[model samples]
Target: MSEPLSVSERDGHCSLVLTRPARGNSLSADLVEAMHEALDSAERSGVRLLSIEGDGRNFCTGFDLAGLEATADGELLARFVRIEELLARIWAAPFTTLAVAQGRTFGAGADLFAACSVRLALPDASFSFPGAAFGLVLGTRRLARRIGEDAALSVVTSGAVIDAERAARLGLATGIVQPDELDAVKQRARRDALRLDTHTIAALRQAAGDNPIELDRDLAALVRSAARPGLVQRIIAYRAKAQDKNRTDRAAAPSTFQEGAVR
Candidate 1:
């Protein structure tokens, strides 16, 4: 199998690309492990800027649900806990963290984007936090810190798709940039990241907000949600409902097309 992540460093900037385009760059167990390893390396290297991007089509479609049928509830809960840990690391990173997202950034993928210090979305990108649909509480605090309590509550509860424009307006995304402008955005981010020493950056981040206690609380919340009985069943049911909705939409599309043709 191909590698799940690509990591490269230049100057003071480290770029981590999610390379599993075939799987929508979903966070499988292997991908999550690779991310932790990459982050560890970046931290040791004292990289000033850490940029994350997806290889194709989508930034990430969220957690990998390919083997949901075979996986046990305990395993699923462990996966979510690890994902929450990854998000926490990004949220409190000493170096500046940037996420350039495109296409469908949903669930934990959207949480990953929110964890970054700078979030840039492509014009076609859309975000939805559907973890609530399955009773998962990942990234709630971090997202609220990014936007606001009410806004985060509304989005998570409703599972509404937030377009790039709305994401920027709500402050979930720093900006919307075309593919051509991405390089410039990264360059600017690099400059900002290198402006301060790692120690100062870490200190500033601490002073600005976020603490170990809150991080622990976030992890605890996720664990509590994931530990609920029937997690596997909950996810299975959610996926089934989503699939049914997709089928219904697709079935309606043909009739709408025929109507337009008749007109």
Candidate 2:
């Protein structure tokens, strides 16, 4: 198989693109590992900006459901831990980080977008956080920091879907543009990012005081939740309900169930 992820350097930005189009760019164990390595490489290369995007129809649909079902608990825990660590790294990156989301961005994918310094989306992009339905605590604190506590709570609890417009209004997305304009927007952002020296960027982040001390606690809670006697069974049941709802919604009209693959 070809690489599931790829990274390249441009004028002033390191671009990371998820390459698992056929799989809806889901975050599989290997893909997550590749993402972690890419982020590390971006930081070490001193890139002024790091841009992340998906190469397929959707930005991402969350964690890989098939992998989740197949892996043993020990291996699954390791993957989840690495995923949380990757999110934390992105959240704390000294330089600018941008997530250019298109199509669907859900679940851990939404968490990844939430962790970025700036989130830009195409006009048709949609986002949702569905982990709560599965009792997962991933990225809760960081998301609240990004979009405020009240909105974050509503989002996670309700599994509400938001388009690019509402996403920008709610502070979840920084900006929205037409799909064809994505490259130009990225170039503009790249220029703006390159203008800031590394020290200045670090100083800005420091002054913002966005350091998150509670994320570790949240991760611990997620571990506990996952280890509950019937949590996996609950997850399977929840997925069944979601799938039924999706089918009903699709039959009613077009399905708006873009809330990632917590399924």
Candidate 3:
């Protein structure tokens, strides 16, 4: 199997590419660990900017659901805790963090995008936070902070897929750009990231209300949610419902032949 993540560093910038196209770059345990490792490396190297993108059609489809049948509730809770930790790290990072998302960025994947300082979504991108469907309270505060509390509440409760335009309107996405424009965006981000010295950057982050207490509360919420009884069962039921809806939608969709016949 190929490595789930690719990390590259240049100047004071570190880039993390999610390489698990087969898995829709989902946050598997290995992938999450790789990300933490990359973050550690970037911090040690004094990286001023960190950018995250995924290879293939989709950015990330959220948590890896494969082998969930065999995964115990305790194990699932542990995985969620680690994911929350990763998000908290990104949310509180002194350096700038950028996420360029395309295709489906769902659940915790959306949370990851929200954690970034610069969230750039491609025209084809869509986002949904369905962790609430499975009774997971991950990243609620960060998301509310990014957008507004009312908007965040609506999005989280509705579990509706927000297109790139809608995401930008909601302030869930900082900007929307085509794939070709990404390099220029990155250039701008890097420039902005380096505008202040490292020390001043850290100071600005603190001054801008990067609250450790709130982060701790977010983590606590996640732990409380994930530690609930029958977590695996709840997730299983949620996935089943989603799969049923997808099948129903597909069945109701008009096929090419049917459309031609109608015409």
TM-score of each: 0.96, 0.91, 0.95
The CA lDDT at 60 in model 2 is: 88
1-263 per-residue lDDT for model 2 (tens digits): 98999889976689899999888798988899998888878778889999889987888888787844555666666677888888888877877899989888988889989889889988878898888897777888888888899999999999998999999999999998888888898888888898888778877876776456555676686677666555556567778998888777677766454433443
Clashing residue pairs in candidate 3 are: none
Better lDDT candidate (2, 3): 3
Residue pair clashes in candidate 1? none
Tens digit per residue, CA lDDT, model 1, 84-122: 999999999989999999988988999999999999999
> Where is model 2 more than 4 Å wrong at Cα?
254-263
Kindly report which residue pairs in candidate 2 clash with one another.
Answer: none
Evaluate model 1: give its TM-score. Answer: 0.96
What candidate 1 gets wrong by more than 4 Å, as runs, is 254-263
Ranking by TM-score: 1, 3, 2
